[model samples]
Target: MCTVCGCGTSHDHDHGHDHAHGHSHGELHFGHGPAGAQVAGMSQARLIEIETDILSKNDRFAAANRQVLQARGAFAVNLVSSPGSGKTTLLCKTIEALGDQPLAVIEGDQQTANDAERIRATGAQAVQINTGKGCHLDAHMVGHAMEHLDIAPGSVLFIENVGNLVCPAGFDLGEDCKVAVLSVTEGEDKPLKYPDMFTVSKLALLNKTDLAPHCDVDLDLYEANLRRVNPGIEVLRLSARTGEGMREWIAWLRGNLGRKVPQAAE
Candidate 1:
């Protein structure tokens, strides 16, 4: 089992592993570890040690992936969100808006090649990575996917991470920046609920705005909560279905493109 997310390490099984046995409280409580996750028959200290080891190995691969992108002068962004946040739709629209500018997509899902096919239909190069039981895409997986892609110099690579808000936040995939996508239908308090995801993201897109009025969502509150979680995160309200705010979204992408990602401090 993965110490970080408590899911099976193999990708051929279900993504989330639900350990039925909870604490003696008759409910599941995962507060047993510094890592905030618990696995049966594992001590908190042991879990922390294993998680550190996993992340350290992942970081090495991430550094290598970053070096490869930097050498090609390519910019990469890891798009993360929960399922049904319209992340794939946003990517397809972004691909169309960027018409001729070099672009490629890395689609990460627990199963199926649907999203990758959607990206390819936009006439952009795409690679699909299916992590069957893995909760999120790791640096090693992204590194392998890059090998199958013909990423152009100065191109923009959008890595659409598996639909997950928790696990993906802790794993860096060597992207220049992380972008958080939240649907208005998902509630305005999402930023507060998933603080780590918003905190690590460079930009937050409040997607599916076309349904905001019908959904009775408070867009202002969402922006306020996002700012509360990440003071410097750029927030944009856009509906990929309606093409609302896409120009600004596209412009933001262009502005960030070609900028070198800084190396992590030791």
Candidate 2:
């Protein structure tokens, strides 16, 4: 098993990641040693080597998956968010809102198929990959999932990654961009806390607008914090529950699709 995300004894499977859509390509999981890191006699270099090796293999799979998706003319978007950031709700909203676009979902979860079931409810083709104790989804799983899923060319492919803010940031599943989601119930300083995840993300979605007034969140500070970590990050505030800012979010999604995704009628 790989040391980083608990990848040693694994089986290939697919499950909904909610936003992670956590799927198992060949045996990928993103968790540490139970509760902590195993750092007794291992040197930093050894740990780095193990990480590098694991990432290297994953990157290769990601690249291959990218090529296949791109060849089919699909634009892949990787959604990264902490668990319960309303990722699945946002996805469900997006699927219904898009209306006519060709969209496929790859759900990555530790074991449940719930996310995929929800996406399928929207009449979109979806596959679920069960990570089996994995905290994040890897490229090998995605590549294999593409073979099983019937996503069309010129479509938008959404990879709902395994739902950890930390581990998923490091693995690239050949996605065009990483979209990060933040909830109002969380602290505004989350960007500062998870700098790497925010730094690598191209866009940030500030979700749960319906609860903003009731919560003690500082929206201004939140945006400022995001900028502090990623100077060029673009942010959109929306509530998947109420459909607020859905147009903007949809437009952004279209804009990312090489400016080809159709605009939904208001």
Candidate 3:
């Protein structure tokens, strides 16, 4: 039987039907024949085609979202981090630092609106996308949230991706840059182990620096390893819990924003 579709017949043969009987009678071979083989093959091809079509559609939607954001002169940042890496906390601090600036956030998670609630507490317009069973947020989901968000022209939009270091790196969310967050407690060798995540990120946020004294992570060595993989990538070491080293992080963000809008300060 086909376990996937449950449409094919069982291939079990009766022990009672001896081999001697099968020589003359074809009842022993009681499974789908040539016609069924052809049907199964066609079904598999159709499935492959469907998967290809779905990914292509998603890529198109992502490109469209990028164009829309560029036309509006908005900068979108996609935040990727592991669970409990303080991604939401950093976002709250970012919103606070930007004070009175036009900023919106899209929070992605497998369940619960907890992160979105946190962002809202910081006074930023936030939309939560519960991906259900999806491991990562795709561009389609982000685009849908954009419709509900009151994003102004030239505003900053931060997308807090589902807390994951692996799967999220493979998907593009039409963001201007990707920020990868890694806490000191997670170990210094993470960049070497998960090279793809480090490679794709424009900036690496090394969170929980206040706990560096307690952990055995070598900050200098970690930064060296990261630069080896991604030369010229900006790394910010900060602790959201203690608010240490946040100024540098915020300054870098503001500088990037300034480059986009020269009259931003005025």
State residue 129's C-alpha deviation in candidate 1, in Å.
0.5
**Best-fitting candidate, measured by TM-score?**
1
Candidate 3, which segments miss by more than 4 Å at Cα? 1-55, 261-266
TM-score order of candidates, best first? 1, 2, 3
Model 1 off-target regions past 4 Å?
Answer: 1-29, 261-266
RMSD of each: 5.1, 9.9, 11.6
Clashes of each: 0, 30, 0
C-alpha lDDT of residue 19 in model 3: 20
* Candidate 3 lDDT tens digits, 1-266: 12222232233222332121233545433223322222333444443344355556667888988887776667789999889998988889888877887889999999999999999998789999998867778888999999999877778889999988866776778888899999888887888877878899999999988989988889998898888889977898898888887888878777766565543333
Give the range where candidate 1 is weakest over 10 consecutive residues by summed lDDT: 9-18
Top candidate (lDDT): 1
True-vs-predicted CA distance for residue 131, candidate 1, Å: 0.4
Task: Please tell me which model should have the higher lDDT, number 1 or number 2.
Answer: 1
Residue 150 lDDT, candidate 2, scale 0-100 = 81
Over the stretch 18-97, how does candidate 1's per-residue lDDT look in tens digits?
34447676886665446576655555565677778778888999999998888877889999999999999999989889
TM-score of 1: 0.88
Report the alpha-carbon TM-score of model 3 versus the true structure. 0.77
Please identify which of the two predictions, 2 or 3, would achieve the higher TM-score against the true structure: 2
The Cα local distance difference test for each model comes to 0.85, 0.82, 0.77
